[model samples]
Target chain A: MQHEREHTLKAFDQDLDRLRALISEMGGLAEHAIGEAMRCLVERDVAGARRIVQDDKKLDALEIETERRVVQLIALRAPMAGDLRDSVAALKISGVVERIGDYAKNIARRVPELQDVGHLEPLSLLPEMARIATHMVHDVLDAFVNRDAEAAVKVAERDQALDDFYDSIFRTLLTFMMEKPNNISHATQLLFVAKNLERVGDHATNIAEMVYYAATGGQMTERLEKAGAL
Target chain B: MQHEREHTLKAFDQDLDRLRALISEMGGLAEHAIGEAMRCLVERDVAGARRIVQDDKKLDALEIETERRVVQLIALRAPMAGDLRDSVAALKISGVVERIGDYAKNIARRVPELQDVGHLEPLSLLPEMARIATHMVHDVLDAFVNRDAEAAVKVAERDQALDDFYDSIFRTLLTFMMEKPNNISHATQLLFVAKNLERVGDHATNIAEMVYYAATGGQMTERLEKAGAL
Candidate 1:
């Protein structure tokens, strides 16, 4: 019986490791999807946009598969306290990943709509925004694996920068719309894409916040601006 | 041991019943918040706005308390299968409730601005939108407690009406702003408030969809569009 208990513990560890790997894999696909979607926007790469849409299929499949594995672990093993938290975190992580997939897909769909806007005036900082979001996802996943609360805190802090970027985009788009009403249709589509990307960043921040809670057993509810350091 | 098992089962049932009741209470609070918020918008009721803002603290505390109880359940009972799903669902419901709280706050914050417009027209359907959302939450919570997949399905189907309402508000506000630019500030703020209310309805729809999956063990991805059809 003792040997059986030890084996179950080993299996539990293996399952959790695999789950984390699956989440990161899904995160990679979503990050790539966001990158390609924005690239399609910048370069008018319709084919790239098509690729992001197609790749969402795999993300969707993996989300379902990961959720099932988590469910199976619960029903099959009756997970204890910490394992329950871990499994619940996996479920929430899968949700955030799937939503990131949707954001990328939304950006991809808006690519064709922006074709007449004459190259989108470069959107100067949005790529940086996407990079920050991608890095947050990657860092949060690593932090989750290592139980690194400080890393999670750093990721959470970056949300203020993301917000600054979002506000800049809003101000810029509002000016573009007001100054050149003719550009409203094209510019509005771009605004939606940017907003979607920003929301993706928000989701990453949410995951990092969850990591903070999981790692430190403390809820980090204070605003990043109030906290002041990354 | 059998008596002990019976006692444990009874205690679990009591917790489940309490959780269901608390969610219903939170839902009612959120629904009232939404209604009063719209009243503030239409009537420019500063007092109503103040009331909504004050009540938001209650919703926030309810969410925190709900989460604490759900997490405590995980620590105390290594729940499996349906019990596990219910606990996780409780957590998810708290997320939706918090978001609803935010929309209410947005609506309340806009009251001082709405007073500036003085008899704006788009306020007509704004309350309807909030009402539909509040109804969806109540219906979904009922479905969850009763395991009524059909009720969940019905609520899921009505999602588009809310979106359609959103689109209507958008067009009305944009047209109003263009034709009567004096109302731009108020109209724009109301536009955002309407959008936030619409989003609350969407989250409620998401919860209804989750309840459907929980009750029926069906895949949710394929049904998002169909789920919009009440």
Candidate 2:
């Protein structure tokens, strides 16, 4: 009986590992979708945008599967302590992954409209913004995979950089519009593009916070607040 | 032992009701915030916007409390079947409410930026869009509270109204900039306001879908396809 009980413990452990692997896998896929979507924006690649939309299905399926597995694990194992933390975290992280996938889809959805609007006067800043936001998404996922607190902290702090880039784009576009009235059409679309990237940055920050929770079983954002950091 | 079991069942049912009430309260607060934020936009009332931001703390606190109670219930009761459905639905609904609050907060944050700028051409459509979206949020919450499937379906179908309004706002803002070069700054801010409303509309639709799920337990949006239906 004792041997059988030990065997079941091994099985539960395997399930936990599987859950982690699936989440990380989904996280990577979500990051790829974000990457290609950003690439679509900078390059004006409609086909790439289409791919992100098409690929979202797999991410969605993975998300639903992860949810089911977590619930089942909770039910079957009645997991407590660290196991419970992990199962709950998977649920929250899956929600975030699903949303990140949606953002990727959103970036693609704008491609068709933005493609019609011709390039804005200051194109470099928008793409540069996308580049940084995309990299932040990548870093947060990597941090999660390696359980790296420092990397997660880095991702969280990088949100301010995205904000700075957004402001720069806004100011540059403002000047461009003042110079040429017709630039308005392209500039508006670029604004949406920048806003989307900012939102993506926000989501990455959210994921980083989650990783902080996972790493320490304690919320790190609170620490940031206590330290008088925004 | 029999009496103790009966007491446990009664306590679990009461807990479920309390969870329902808690979500309804949060939903009510969020729905109010969205409405006030929209009114602030339409009236260009900075004070209203300030109110939304201030009230958001209340919503946030409610969210945290709701989450805590949910985890506690799950840990203590280990509910199954319908009881489990009720608790899980509360968790999902709380998330939807929290996001709605965030959207309201976003609208408020943008208000200060737009207060000085005269309401541009696209600004006209925002009020209508906000009205439609807020109604959707209210209706969805009503559906959840009353278990009214018809109301849920109605909210789902009305999402297109929000989309059409967004497109009108988008085009008008574009034309505003093209026709009058001086309106670029105001035009851009209005653009952000419209997009924020559109996003709030999406969150409204998300809540409506959740109402559908709680009432029907069938995931329609998955197979429904994203037809750019706002």
Docking class of 1: incorrect
DockQ per model, Cα: 0.22, 0.52
Worst window of 10 by summed lDDT in candidate 2 chain B: B221-230
Please report the candidate that would top lDDT against the real structure: 2
Predicted chain A of model 1: TM-score relative to the true chain A? 0.92
Q: Name the regions of candidate 1 deviating beyond 4 angstroms.
A: A1-6, A44-54, A71-84, A122-125, A221-230, B1-8, B43-61, B64-87, B106-120, B177-188, B220-230
- The worst-scoring run of ten residues by lDDT in candidate 1 chain B lies at B221-230
Model 2 C-alpha lDDT versus the unseen true structure = 0.77
| Residue-level lDDT tens digits of model 1 in A111-161 | 777665575562656777788877877787788777777787778778778
For every candidate, the chain B TM-score is 0.92, 0.86
TM-score of each: 0.83, 0.89
Clash list (residue pairs), candidate 1: B157-B228, B157-B229, B157-B230, B158-B230
Per-structure clash totals for the candidates: 4, 0
The weakest ten consecutive residues by lDDT in model 2 chain A span A116-125
Relative to the true structure, how large is the alpha-carbon lDDT of every model? Answer: 0.77, 0.77
The share of true interface contacts that also appear in candidate 2 amounts to 0.52
